[model samples]
Target: MLEIKNLHASVLDIDDSEILKGIDLKVGKGEVHAIMGPNGSGKSTLANVLMGRFDYVVTEGDVLIDGNSILKLRPDQRAHLGMFLAFQYPAEIPGVRPWQFLKAALDSKADANGEDKMSVRNFSKLFDEKIEAVGINPNLVKRSLNEGFSGGEKKRNEMLQLEVLQPSLAILDETDSGLDVDALRIVAEGVNSMRSPERSFVVVTHYQRLLNYITPDVVHILVKGKIVKTGGPELALEVEKDGYKQYMAEAEVNA
Candidate 1:
């Protein structure tokens, strides 16, 4: 459902320090892919580039969703095209309540698809159901979005968005970070519940703890902006046991 071909991206403000040299990846429907790497491996950069973040410029290649090139599309345009990103660190909107924020996003998506807006009653019903499913208190929805929320709560809120929006492709950028074991399990369960033949997920993580809950179909090792290894779930175990030392050594040799 998503394809990246020889993608190269770099920050435009500096001397154009290249982050992603050439990232080529393909994720099909119903597939779960995990990108594991050390710091400065361009894992987060790839996510931002896919979302068309302004700080980074794509110097070469293309990112295609389905069959269309999405490089020219704005961030909102990418979202409208069934792409969703759960950021590693969710932003805090102090004044916006959870319901209001979600309703606005959902309405914008509906309007983009030429569909009628969701009725207040229907939205309330679905919202409550989603909140309960994610183990969030209904009263929390009335509070400001992610303002003073615990790390786990923010992660759950992200999953709540995933549950409501149900985007075709979801890129979860370290959603498991800072989560306690119980909270991590809850978030992982929420993500696992969304698996389907029509949906796909790309999970970027540093540890294999999250992978224990969500088994990925393909595991890719990214070192120095390139995917150095691709394998099954066993690859995650190897990383967890031996760390990325071998991978880093290989990368140094290649460089």
Candidate 2:
């Protein structure tokens, strides 16, 4: 479970322009929430701030996971508390093989949970199973993480991390972008397989196409760094059909 209250965050320089203004959201276990917004609505900023990115300054309010404040925690500490953010654009880390990265992640998580470290052979078996489930080539495990990978491959790699890490709350920041229909299906399947009463997801996307694959329990429309409306899955269809014109008008009236 996660709760954000009156969150006012801003860039850390010059005028210190705020991007997330008085946000209030609650995500319970077994829930999927989709945030749909136009460009410059601060969706990505919310994701980064939740991950404890240093460039953003929190001017007010707090972020709590499982009833404890995490505003002061380091990025790794927040990660240890079962938070994962799949970026809109995954970075390519040269010289870091997928196997090595996964091993480190597994070990770190194991240490966090006070479990025994996994052996290389055992981890390889688990990795093989997950990679197969996500339909990723086993050969990719030997290559640098995301290096020279196709767009779909990169998205699959992020799903691979989702499967391996198994965090309690996964925030996917536009994972469907740049993905073809086949790739989107694969990614959606991967996410769906992980849905459980003990887990939740926050999917931030621009289009309703992704929602067709991963239906959210709630859909929120964000405007001008604030959530202007919240509704069920039907709202996604309405947005796709009529666009954000109505939502923008409502936002202007509220402003």
Candidate 3:
């Protein structure tokens, strides 16, 4: 349902700062793909570019969702198109509670799609259900969004949003970072529960720990801003055993 064609991007205000180089990927509906790479391999850059982050300029390439280009759309516009990016470092909104933030987001998406917003009572019911399913404390969500929340709490909150937003394609950028064993399990469960025949996920992670819980149909090795190897789940195991040294050596040689 998502396609990236020769995707090249560079950071704004930096000379010769291109990060992603010629990234081409195709994720069909119901599929799960994992991107694993060393630091500065442009994993997060790809995520931000796909979501239309303004700080990064797409020097070349086109991103298509269901065959239509979204290069000109803003981040929110892409959200309305069923694209969701769970940040590696989720931002804390100091004054807004999760309930308020999510309600307004749902309303906005509903309005955009010419659908009626859910009533407060129904919304509350669903919200409570989701928060529980995602293993988030209801009391914590009542507080300002992500403010004073622990790392695991922030990741759970992201999953709660995913559950409520129900995006067609969810790009989770290092969702497992800073999470402990329990927290990782909770987050993985949240993602696992959301998997379905009509939805897809692009999980970008550095290690194979998260992959143990959520097995991906495909695994890609990204190095030096390019995807150099693509394989099945076995590739992740190989990376875990041998590390990315070989991949990095290959990438450098190719470069």
Candidate 4:
């Protein structure tokens, strides 16, 4: 459902700081792929570039969703195309409550996709159901979007958004970061519940702890902006055991 073709991207302000170098990947419908690498291996960069973030420029290659190019589309347009990105550091919108933020986002996506906007009554019912499913305290959501929320709460908040939005392709960039055992398990359960035949996921993370609960169909070792190795779930265990030292050394020499 998602394809990245020889993608190359670099920081817009610096000419020499190329982050992604010829990344080629294909994720099929219903597949879950895990991308594991060391710090600064361009994992988060890939996520940001896919969303058409303005800070980075794609110098070569293309990103296609269901055979259509999303390279030139804006971030909102990409969201409308069923691409959702759970940020590593989810931004805090202090003035907006979760209810208001989500309703507007759903309406915007509906208008962009030519779908009918969800009525308040229906949205309220669904929102309440998801809030409970994600184990979020209703009072917390009423406060502000990621405002004054603890680390675990923010992660659960992302899961709540995912459950409510139900995007086609979900790219989770280090959602497991800063999460404790219980919080991590809750987030993984949230992701597991969302898996389906029509939905795909690309989870970018540094550790394999999250992978234990959400077993991925494919595991990729991305080093120095390139995917150097691809394998089954066992690859993650290998990374856990041997670490990324060998891969990092090899990639730095070649990449």
Error of 2 at 174 (Å): 0.4
lDDT of 2 by residue, 52-116 (tens): 99999999999999999999998888888889999888999999999899899878878987989
TM-score of every candidate relative to the true structure: 0.98, 0.97, 0.99, 0.99
Evaluated at residue 38, the lDDT of candidate 2 is: 85
- Top of the candidates by lDDT: 4
Which parts of model 2 are misplaced by more than 4 Å?
Answer: none
User: Which model, 3 or 4, shows the larger lDDT?
Assistant: 4
lDDT of candidate 1 over 1-255, digit per residue (tens) = 999999999997878599998999999998999999998899998988899889999999999999899999999889999999999999998889999888898999899889999998999899999999999866777888998898988999999999999999999998989999999999889889999999999999999999999999999999999999999999999999999999989988887
Residue 19 in model 2: shift from native, Å?
0.4
Single out the weakest 10-residue window by summed lDDT for candidate 1: 135-144
Runs with alpha carbons beyond 4 Å of true place in candidate 4:
none
Q: Where does candidate 3 clash, by residue pair?
A: none
Taking the tens digit of each residue's C-alpha lDDT, what string does model 4 give over 1-255?
999999999999897999899999999999999999999999999999998899999999999999999998999999999999998899988989999899999999999888999999999999999999999999999997999999999999999999999999999999999999999999999999999999999999999999999999999999989999999999999999999999988887895
Q: Regarding lDDT, does 1 or 4 come out ahead?
A: 4
Ranking of predictions according to TM-score:
3, 4, 1, 2
Model 3, which residues run further than 4 Å from truth?
none
The order by descending lDDT is 4, 3, 1, 2
Question: On a 0 to 100 scale, what is the lDDT of residue 84 in model 4?
Answer: 96
**Candidate 3 residue 253 C-alpha distance from true site, Å:** 1.2
